[model samples]
Target: MANARNLSTSSEPLNPKTFLSSIFDAAVAAADAKLTIRGHLPQKPKGRTVVVGAGKGAAQMAVAFEKAWDGPIDGLVITRYGYSAPTERIEIVESAHPVPDEAGLMGSRRLLEKVAGLTDDDLVVALICGGGSALLPSPAPGISLADEIAVNQALLASGAPIAAMNTIRKHISTIKGGRLAAVAWPAKVVSLVVSDIPGDNLALVASGPTVPDTGSRADALAAIAAYGMKFPDAVMAHINSRAATAPDPADEKFARNEVYLIASASVSLEAAAADSRRQGIEAVILSDALEGEAREVGSVHAAIAREVATRNRPFTKPVLILSGGETTVTLRAKGKGGRNSEFLLAFAIGIDGLNGINALAADTDGIDGSESNAGAFCDGSTVARMRAVGVDAKAMLAGNNAWTAFKAVGDLFVTGPTGTNVNDLRAILVR
Candidate 1:
């Protein structure tokens, strides 16, 4: 699994409303949102069943588990602020994400301490996802909270892919990189993961707090050096000391751990394709692991959709195309948009008012790159709309201001945290 930063962009034909809804359905299905995990609980573990989790989806997953389970369960979870949901058994703690904060550090400590001293009979259900690496930042020995915060900021600005960012994070933290499970040793660790990374490498999601890490301290150091990052004396010292003796998995005792990838971008894309089929549209899934620059992929998708619409060569008219994966924006311009918005903007520019073609691009979590809107909607009329408002699509794209441009035309689609994250979903419908 790679970090969110490694996501690449690719495109296909999609319809605004139908495509958006289909994508949403696929994300929900991939997350197995309706299949509350508690339904699979092993009959109230012989000992206490403690629910400990961290991520943007942690609170919602905890709530779902609570709703499905029958016995009295007690636990706590930390999630990105504004991503919390009501839960009776599990007390939801709000924390910062994409960047470490004091609350996250404190909460991480509390969760770590909470799971301490678990026996073989006890169980620790870990709900992990894309944002947990930053959501649960617990600095290792001698690394001050401030220092950890500084490193986190550096990593975010570095634009390194998710796997690389997480590699560094695993070494710097006390809970990540299988340390959490190591701490809760002897107890069975049931990790329910909503994978956000390509290839679904379990060890990389959320820094593999519950899963065993195949990476090492050397790998972490390599990532830091690759980015040319400098750390404080204390942080550097810790890294130097552990450089040769990265936390040893064999030394730790979390052998009973089991991880389940409950959701993924591939699964979401398949579900979306199925939804399109239900609508009597010949839907095709382009790729679930598509990566690279967003705008460029948007142009390619537009080209394919245009071909199918005009000549009915590759895919006949009345076809729906779907794709799901995270995309990255290099951010050469001081743009106020996420990759999805940028993709939509570029797609609109490429189509140039191709009648009967519509599309939608959205991040599954309903939030795109620190912005309020999930993504955006585009159609044959999109170019005309921008022209009417005197909005130059090319200029807006160059400025990375697709969010603002879409907002002006009231085409911004906001879903307020859809309670799950499966990267991004793009759908194009040619009718």
Candidate 2:
């Protein structure tokens, strides 16, 4: 991996917005496939090298692998629509995310076919990341694509954590869990993952397409039941069928397989912290594994920031409080916003115009929920500025319309598709 020191640091006399952006960029850079993947790439195989993957970062990882590889490599990878990276050898296909589509279904079937005939000498390099669960959709037999999409929509709005959502996903899909790796049995499989889950659980990342699934069908059904997810009869039946069981962990086929976390939320959080210190800011990483309701987490962080800004109990001024991990947003209003936006709005309300505090909350993949904006930003002036415009911050948050509120206030942070995903990056600058 490239040294974090080589990354660009925040300029002197730190401007909050610029400094925060720099920190985010550093975090994303630290997780970029081009920089971290080559070191983890396995030795070239004597037989054909087949690459297959699906995620927001899969296309980018494919590009990196193609560039670094010496032998002839051919494969297909699916990425979120508009998140495709330029690549020569590997085929990159665009597909829907957070919901499955026909494109993903076709691509996933083709990916499985590509590795089906591979021999023990052949190599299967699987690039997996945050959105793969939805990007590589192969509905289990007897389940329709529409049925799978409905289940996914319910899971997303159910406010379930990524792990739970993925558990349900793996049980209903033919490609997720350990099924994908099982199909490529006898061929050496190497999975390179960019983790976007809390605790970096290999089985939860992208629903563990290339690793053994530790979760059981009962676990998946329990998640569905917990979320009160109503799936079609066919979908439910498929989940209950014997075919739904994933490959067992003790399977010898997986003995030759390897899973490597090329980048993760913790690594990116540390990179952000390192950059902050370089700028002479006291950096404290609260947690890289935080998980909870978005608004609730935001309120708690706001309290911490408020104390630091006013009492300076935890740290002195010019402190950057950082955290990484995924947060959930339960849908109450039919509002157009993601977890990050919701978090920022709640945070803004919690701070309530306390001065000298600025913050940024964003998904590292450059998309928050289903919105175009990566996330939103707020400083001391946010609440007052919204009030000045006759906008009720509380009402907007109540309606779960943080994106619209942030858009009205011109505070949306828009970094187009950052070819990676390490979950969320949140920073509060106390000055």
Candidate 3:
């Protein structure tokens, strides 16, 4: 990967927004939207092919499936409000994201009703993706959608990782934990997945609606305890009751169920790297499975960039270091900013100056967290800029106010919605 010292800054030209958009476009291209989950569809069934899903990518997947399938197809999908894609046949519903709302709960109920009466001759295509867990929120008996929303908000603010959050969600949800597929018993289930989780664990992605879940209600309670969040007695009782239910049991009904990860973070990263190469920038993807605390990863990347800048070790200059995967932020700040902004802010503090480094951090889905910003950007002079503005970068980092800080410096990248979610992408350009 290129180091900071190797990047040549000139009076020629540079557009931070355009460069970041290019990298994101490459990442999306790598996901291969044309494939979707349709490639895994089984032969035409005697019954109908009902497509049901929930996530940021569900609508897009619906569009892909519509074009690929030649047989009878009808169903509904749920996505975050304003994240909807243009769809002709399948019903696409929008609802609150990151927090389950009345609309999401109703949508989940309708989805369940849609597939409940299917027979062995029918097929159920589940387009699962990131944010589905929140987008398909159906609280179990004794749990209310209001309570679920409260817990979800708390969990998100607690900084629990996506996997842990989904574990809790699966247990609390009536449709998750493979219950959706189980309800469609006798009907063949094909789960087409676009992974947002770091390890691409199908069960954790979208709470494993069609895929079997290895987690249990106990796991959900444990996650709640791990985060020290308070819940109502009814909520606690619901978790206790689910202890009797084994999430993933071997059953004759499940024999026809299958889950496949058709698209992933690595795919997006490789596409970005290829794009960089095409742009005359040598790019190397560090890994597609990178995971950890967001700020810590930022520090590590900054250190590597420093090494390349000062000593040309491990890798020389003029190459872009790229990586994909989900990195989480344990929210300690009341300020606005997503993981991408936090990562960039941390990287900026580490690099400070020494010239010739430019980097971009963004969520492939476009919206970072609940914020409108895709992510944030940093250059060699970022530190100087912060200092000149009389803003204490360290203090902002402490408050988890990287978004506010970046916005103050006009470095936040807001792309609205990119209509995809392959996790996080980082591009470190070393001079």
C-alpha root-mean-square deviation, each candidate? 6.3, 2.8, 3.3
Error of 2 at 336 (Å): 0.9
lDDT of 2 by residue, 1-431 (tens): 24333212434355678889999999999999999999998988889899999899898999899888888999999999999888888999898988889998899899899889789989999999999988888888788899999988888888888888888888888888878889998999999999999999987888888887678889889988887888889988988989888778789989998889999999999999988877667699999999989999999999999999889868877789999899998888998899999999999998986988999999999999888999989987898888888888889888888998888889999999999999999999888
Residues 1-431 of candidate 3 have per-residue lDDT tens digits of 35322213444464545665788887876665566555666678888899899899788888888888888899999999998888877999998888888999899999999899888889998888888988998888778888888878887777677888888777777898788988998899988889988878888888888777677767777878987877777777777784425456576777878778888998888778777766666788888878777899899999988998888867877778898887878878687778888888889999997687889999888888778888988987887898789888889888888887888789887777766788998998876
lDDT of each: 0.79, 0.89, 0.82
Q: Which parts of model 3 are misplaced by more than 4 Å?
A: 1-17, 35-38, 243-246
Taking all chains together, each candidate's TM-score versus the true structure is 0.88, 0.96, 0.93
- TM-score-wise, the better of 1 and 3 is 3
Please give the TM-score that candidate 1 achieves against the real structure.
Answer: 0.88
lDDT of 2 at 58: 90
The alpha-carbon deviation from the true structure for residue 17 of candidate 3, after best TM-score superposition, in angstroms, is 5.0
Model 1 lDDT per residue over 99-149, tens place: 789999889989988899989899888888778888888898778888988
